[model samples]
Target chain A: MGELVVDELEVQKYQEQEVEENGLPLVLLYGPLSLLNVFGSESLLNNFRLIKPWESPEIPLHEYLITHAKNVKALVCLGKTELDSKAIHCLPSLEIVVTCAAGLNHIDLIECRRRGIMVCNAGNAYTIDGADYAVGLLLDVLRRVTSGDRYVRSRMWPLKGEYRLGSKLRGKRVGIVGLGSIGSEVVKRLVPFGCKISYNSRKKKPGVPYPYYSSVYDLAVNNDVLVLLCSLSEETFHCIDKDVLTALGKDGVIINIGRGPLVDEEQLVRFLVNGDIAGAGLDVFEDEPAVPRELMELDNVVLSPHKAVFTPESFIELQELIVGNLQAFFSKKPLLSLYKNALSASS
Target chain B: MGELVVDELEVQKYQEQEVEENGLPLVLLYGPLSLLNVFGSESLLNNFRLIKPWESPEIPLHEYLITHAKNVKALVCLGKTELDSKAIHCLPSLEIVVTCAAGLNHIDLIECRRRGIMVCNAGNAYTIDGADYAVGLLLDVLRRVTSGDRYVRSRMWPLKGEYRLGSKLRGKRVGIVGLGSIGSEVVKRLVPFGCKISYNSRKKKPGVPYPYYSSVYDLAVNNDVLVLLCSLSEETFHCIDKDVLTALGKDGVIINIGRGPLVDEEQLVRFLVNGDIAGAGLDVFEDEPAVPRELMELDNVVLSPHKAVFTPESFIELQELIVGNLQAFFSKKPLLSLYKNALSASS
Candidate 1:
């Protein structure tokens, strides 16, 4: 007994079983219904015990979370999942939350701060793709790419006549809302298209050459196109209201790749319908999966399911970052994409 | 007799009437069926006795041109109308042809040269808009902007869950077919999007830094995207055929803002239908508005009705150039935007 000399095969089998069941850390895979299956989450499964509460159809996510996922030390949240105080309280032992998204509006920073839990985001993974989508939306709306597609699809060109001419993108006065990583990239991309780039952020981005407007209204008043790339905060909520829309005027277009709530969707729809604004290219909605019905037939408004950061490249980058950040967290090494503002606030 | 006459009001009335009827140098508006009404041609009407054969509808264009337009000294052509030898023969006094388009494929350069007919095109008016459209199509195809619009329009997003993730536009290797003004602008636009640009012009463009592949096949082999910006000619007609498409491979996309026959339409349809290549964004087709029926159901292809260079800004610029060039020709001044290649070859 002291030397443990007997039945090494049985001992090895027992140890292997133990390691298989409990050796790796657990992570709550929180996202859309199809999240765990799609998005190449198998790599995460290889290293962590991934428990998706929504996978079990019989029980609801919150109940399942409280019952079975209490001990999970980490949560891997995807885009737009509400990770508030009540949800955080369900997982009592949760030490870190890693979001596979650029936006963190769903995460409760105050609650997470009070509990002293760490947070990680997708970092620069979304920056390039987000910027690309923003510009793509702007181009699509300006050139009527989507409308032209619809007209062609309906066989309208031959039957009726040529599709109406769209306004040019070159030399457009573009105002970027939020000169963050993604917004900066948007400015860069639009620059070579001959667009005059300016921006509105919470504060002046030091050393940036693009003209900066202090308020969203001032930005809207000056620009022919307002690209909404700012995050949704209390101050930023419904920031693109009727005042901003009116300021943007009849010829101006709005491109929203940020959170839906960042825009006043109802007002936007009314503006778009009444021709108060020229058009909109929206990737996110006020209530996702519930786009305004009026937008269905609009040639000007190009609606997209929130897919700005959902490119294959971004997903791969985010997956790697999630793994890297989690590994770093477990090793007590510096987390790759730690939300340092939140961490520093709590500290 | 008029100098000796004392009736000044009657003389002025006769003079105004004569000017209205035939005094202004006649210009045959050679274009599509509805071209006279669209495209801000009212300004053109003010400058010259603009005669439209298609507008009358009493006789066929050929017959109308023979009877009514034989005395016309200048012709203003719109896009894609066949101004070949046969059409040119009808207008015996056709000293010059001004096409309100970037492409001059329908103008029959060889025939025009043989007949001593000068031709002018839209000049740099199409350059900015053409580049904008090429990049727009590339972005739309890569980001599935048109497809996303369709999906949302079809109400498939909520029903079908999430739209599939597209590949990133960042870091794509792009091959531009022609390195003219528009193609050069396309390079400038795609640079900040992180695309690696190369080209296959007739010869290597001087002082350019991008890699130049002399052959289309080689260009297709190395690039993720092939943008057809070359004018359609004997050499470039059906240039993107089976070999070129195959070389482009399954992941490569084609954005054709050039003339229709620049690509072999039948082979492209087959490649797209069979998934031999990724996708295409086609503004022009082999036949004037008769898009392949097969492409109607495909999400991979985005079809446009040759409106790439038809933005409002371009129209105003083109209208001015059209009038300016005609005035210059009449005044024995150097023609603006003259197709010097065709002129030089003829001389």
Candidate 2:
């Protein structure tokens, strides 16, 4: 019996040696399919064992972590994934956490710090792309491009009545709620349209071309169109509420490409129905994928999925940046580190 | 009978005297509802007798002209209303033919010249608006912006399996087939995208920034995208045929804001299906309102009813230009014309 036990112990030691020799450190990837396609190609993922738990609908979070947790050294997560203190505690070997996207509200940064786990995110990767898309949506909605196309395709030649008339962007006052990278890019695009740009951020930046306003109500009142580009945080939740919408006045358009929580959805629907606000172009929603039926019925609103940065160029850039971060972390470098500063500064 | 005729003539003279005192000439208008809105408003027609043949699908050219022809000094017409030599010949007192939109192919220019009839069109009125829409279509088609919106709205969240990736317009080679008013306007807007502009007009204007190509095939072969901005005359009909599509290569996109007959519909359909051409954004069609059913299924193509310049700014500008033309024609002043020079130069 003693000899048999010795043999079993020898076999266990051999298996451990094999795993150490050939197995790679863990990387948990979450997000959409594009996230995987962008970063998990064999050539890019050769240095790590990339595990994507969200790829299948049936894979429960606890089951996934329990099965793969012992070997996980790093995790790459998305906005929807639940990565709280409890989830972090399950992964005994997790040394770092990286996000494939810019937003970090999903991950508990304080918990990660408490556990001495490093965290990094892809910031400014989608700024220009998102800004470009927001402007595109604004123009699409105001100009009624999609509706016009539908009218024409229906064999209605030379649209008349209200359908024939569409507002132009030229010379309209555009209010941007945030003057960060995306908002600044939007300003750049709108400049050529000859629009007057007004912005309301937490504080004013020097030497910017647009006029800055401290109060959201003042910004909404003066501007013909309001663009929400601020980040979603505790302070900014429901920042553009009923009072701000009311201050926007009649014949005002509100475009939200930021977070859905930035604007009160119920108030937005009410304002739209009551004709207090002229129209809206929304790319993000409160519940997402389950957009309100009320918004869908309105002809005035233009809706897009939360896909502002899904352009090929932006996607490629995001992939490269995420991969670079991973490689840097493995090399014991700073990991393009931008957590505490961005949080504090943005907050 | 002679006394009755004399009395009728006296009554007609009395009406003419009253009309002249009112200081408005008779204005005959035709075409779609939007055109009527722009050119045939109540205020515009208040001074003049506005004659519309809505009851009769076809304008009764001779009878209508004979009845109201004598005092109808200015005639406002649009495309799809036949204004042939017979019609022009009958309107003996007609001094001007002012079209509310661009494209004068339907007008009998030779007859107008022989009869010394002054002709003016709403030149450059729709240029900026049309160019803006074309660019919008290009960006929208390439980015799959509308498709993305549709997918999300239809409850297809977290889309999987090879989504259509969009290319950026920045730094792409854009070939303008004709550098006329609309083409030039398109170039101005496209400049900000950092696209390299090339052109192939009948004759190259001096000091233009873009390189000129003498042959359409050459332009198609070299360009990443070819935009048809030339007119559709007999000489330029089917100019961008199968050979041109072949030369454009498989990856090139074609945008035609010009005439649809400039492209061979059969060849275009074939190319679009077989992936000989990447995609197309068409505002005009071979037959308006009867778009090819097959083209509708292709995700690559974007179709708009022939409304490239249906903006409020252009609408107001068109009205003002038409009104100015009427004012100038009544004063017997030289018409602010383009065709006399363009035709001669092309010949």
Name the best candidate (by TM-score). 1
DockQ of each: 0.46, 0.31
Which pairs in model 2 have colliding backbones?
none
Q: How far off is residue A143 in model 1, in Å?
A: 1.1
Per-model TM-score on C-alpha atoms = 0.90, 0.85
True contacts kept of 1: 0.77
lDDT of 1 by residue, A6-47 (tens): 243532332211112656776777876356444455467667
Q: lDDT tens string, model 2, A1-347?
A: 00112233433332221123345555666554344554434434555655655544497876767675557777777545657887887778888887766666778777777777777776777776677677777777777766655555454553342244467777789999988888887887777666799999999889886788998889998999999988788878998899999989887999898889999999999999888988888888887766887876666787787767666677667667667777888777777755664234222
